[model samples]
Target: MNLEHFDAIYQRAAERKGGELALESMLSTPLTQQELLSITDDRWLSAFSMKVFQSGMSWKVVRNKWPNFEELFFGFKIGPLLMLSDEQWEAKSIDKRIIRHHSKVMSIAANAQMIYEAGIKHGSFAQMVAQWPSDDITGLWLYLKKHGQRLGGNTGPYALRQMGVDTFILSQDVEAYLRSYKIIEGGRDTKRSLAQCNQAFSFWQQQSGRSLTHISQIIAFSCGDNRM
Candidate 1:
């Protein structure tokens, strides 16, 4: 399908945000591949767990209690986390220091196992993420969804973005923009729809010479009522 040039979208976003300078200031840059590589496995698990807990909950509350999560989970060290006994996990589910959600509490260990296996296969989970091609970020997202718990939909993508992986979040505004342009059709979570989005973002990246993160923000800013 044909798509509008990235310049036109940027112009609209710039107008909405006040000016080109203001729009540029609002866009965020993803970390470099080397920077992503330098991060350890534990940190990746921490990011994943945070996103999982933050889902359908107050981010501020999760952030406030994050230190306790780190302490209780042994800083999310993969080795120790993978070894927790059933009774130990049960105790953590009711711990007052955390949000007390049993299912989400269980996801921590499940995701840790996913990361541990990825580490064994790819030298480290960070290496696998660092080496993933930015052009095919959906593939990485699919991998997480298949291997980890509660990592489907935006959860996996959000976690990857938080951990410095170059990815575009399919937020409400972004989805609306894609549908308006006819760049995607039907269910947003379907593989076909995601592939369409990947193609559209790839085209925009080529036209703008920008990262997926920036392009995503531009699309969001260009639409909806986010005017500044």
Candidate 2:
């Protein structure tokens, strides 16, 4: 059931969305260099932390309390945040401002440390993300999972997408499309599923000269989901 080419995927998406213009609007666009440069390390940490907390929770709850989380984490400033003791983090975990998930609260602290290290080692976390090769975005996902805490699965990719990094998100519709094309197994979610999907995407990048973001959107669009 795979489309013959990228243009076929685009055409199916356009038809599914009612017209070409509508499908164009649904495509994910990466931010410009100036805009990406404007994003600070603190903000990057916040976005990562937010995505970690948003996992398996109501996004509305996360969004509603985001300002409070920002305030509590001291604007997610790496230096001051790295100074927090375990007791301090545990204390905040029980606070009423943000979600009270203790492990997720601790993930904020852990991820902040990861960000601080990335900044020191790579000039800045933003630089690492901006300069990472889009041709191997799965590597970025792997790095996040290994270096940062609790960033595995779709969370890492989704966060990258939110930050305007060129990456793909394997939503259900996208997974279905991948399975239809024999890119991934129809079996349960597994490490093999991720590896195969990543390989398939890298192959498509070589074949189409398009960003992972665009390819992922086209596949999801082909499924007629339209649910970002």
Candidate 3:
């Protein structure tokens, strides 16, 4: 269901309520800026995913930005991602609804080269990530490329970072994907930290003796055909 796609952000939502609960269940955690950038010739979809998270957007991330971001990243030219100029960031910082941190704005502009380079270096960025381990961002990149809603191609990389997608070489969306899969059932998983949310999913594995795909079936029902 659509909830699986939301697995990454649900943890942040949980934190606003801050209560004592088990934390050992943290399955995946957010990566550092350095770690996010450390990703090498990995997921192209992630690169594009980041592009969708533009530094100057009304929408905060991949969800709504996908349609617009998709339209912008066309043909892997990094056109949209590269287009962000320094002036834009300065103007956007005061934006109330958006994540206006300057670091995020600068990162979006700077990441264009990396995203474009990765695609050229690997021949097919999607294939490059798909070749990597499933738990890594590569898997998320490929899966989203293959399955997520095809927006008009306008994801803002800047917003993507805020939303928790790894902006690096497609190595960070891993936890997000894991979280999405866990979101199939939004109980304890929804209340935990990003790490804890992921942990709950793994716990479910042990308790239910099922795989992510199985959980997805229930998630599909929960989402009423994955609308939200």
lDDT of each: 0.91, 0.82, 0.39
Question: Which should have the higher lDDT, number 1 or number 2?
Answer: 1
lDDT of 1 by residue, 91-210 (tens): 999999988999999999999999899999999998899999888899999999999999998999999888777899888888888898887788888889889988989999999899
Candidates sorted on TM-score, descending: 1, 2, 3
lDDT of 2 by residue, 1-228 (tens): 253577778788888888989987878788865677668888888889899989999888899999999899899998898888878988999999888999888888888888888889988888878878765677788889988888988888888889998888878898777777777775524667667777777777777788888889988888846556
**What TM-score would candidate 3 get against the native?**
0.31
Q: Tens-digit lDDT track for model 3 on 68-92?
A: 4334334334565466666755665
Residue 111 of model 3, lDDT score: 50
Off by over 4 Å in 1: none
RMSD in Å for candidate 2, one decimal?
Answer: 2.3
Which sections of candidate 2 miss by over 4 Å? 1-3, 186-195, 206-208
Look at candidate 2 and tell me the lDDT of residue 114: 83
